[model samples]
Target: MQIVDRIRETFRENAAMLREIENKADAFFGKKNLQTSLMQSITMLTTRWVKMPVTP
Candidate 1:
């Protein structure tokens, strides 16, 4: 279960950073072009993460 715990910890850290990113993204929400760019980046990361099998 160590790997699972480690992955959970990693996700927790990412979640914390996402709070700040939320504020940053909010600042660019009104700009459609920038919003797309930010969303694309986020999507790319999430996609990569989802592909990894969480194992212990």
Candidate 2:
């Protein structure tokens, strides 16, 4: 039960983070926004994204 709860919490946190990153990326690329390079944008986003375990 505890493991299940932990998994659920983690999932929720990841979802929120994704939304925030999307908004940030859009603002960084959208109209009247910073003209950051594509590599920089991807790197920034990928860095914060979860460093998850590999499951098969």
Candidate number achieving the greatest lDDT relative to the actual structure: 1
lDDT of 2: 0.80
User: Model 1 over residues 1-56: C-alpha lDDT tens digits?
Assistant: 99999999999999999987877877767557677888999999999999999999
Tens digit of per-residue lDDT, candidate 2, span 1-56: 99999999999999999999988888767834544566678888887675656689
Q: Which regions of candidate 1 are displaced past 4 Å? A: 27-56
lDDT of 1: 0.88
What lDDT score is found at residue 21 in candidate 1?
Answer: 88
Which residue runs of candidate 2 sit more than 4 Å off their true CA positions?
31-56
Evaluate all candidate structures by whole-model CA lDDT and list the values in order. Answer: 0.88, 0.80
